[model samples]
Target: MNIVVDAFWDDEAKVWVASARDGIGIATEAGTMEQLQQKLSIIVPDLLAEDYQGPFEIELIARSHQTVAAA
Candidate 1:
């Protein structure tokens, strides 16, 4: 199984926050990008293993911002 992670620093709180779109949250104040990535690497698999089952499919629908705004 493969998953994508998005990580960034939270300036106000002074911590690294990481999350997978599939719903894993890894937050820490360890103070380095590598540390945050390592932590997330460990946590995401366990989180997905607990929540996900079997193969799944996703669809992406693209539309102009103006079209969405008009609706």
Candidate 2:
């Protein structure tokens, strides 16, 4: 199965937040992108289905913003 996950950097929390947008009931956050990926690796499969042991694909979308001075 294929799963689409949306991720973004929380400015207030200073962390990367990830969630399954396809109604997989998955929401998680981590301090860094690597950490978030690790969390997703485990969380995605478990939430997909019970005893779900197979190859799966995960699509991650990241959105973030920054402030800079324009000269």
| lDDT of model number 1 | 0.51
- Tens-place lDDT digits, model 1, residues 1-71: 55555556666676666555555453344356667656655665555666776343222111212224555
Worst 10 residues of 2 by lDDT: 47-56
Candidate 2 lDDT over 9-70, as tens digits, reads: 99999999888876879899999988988888888888766846657788888899899999
Most accurate candidate by TM-score: 2
In TM-score terms, candidate 1 sits at 0.50
Name the runs in model 2 displaced over 4 angstroms. Answer: 51-53
Write down the TM-score for model 2: 0.88
Clashing pairs in model 2, backbone N/Cα/C closer than 3 A: none
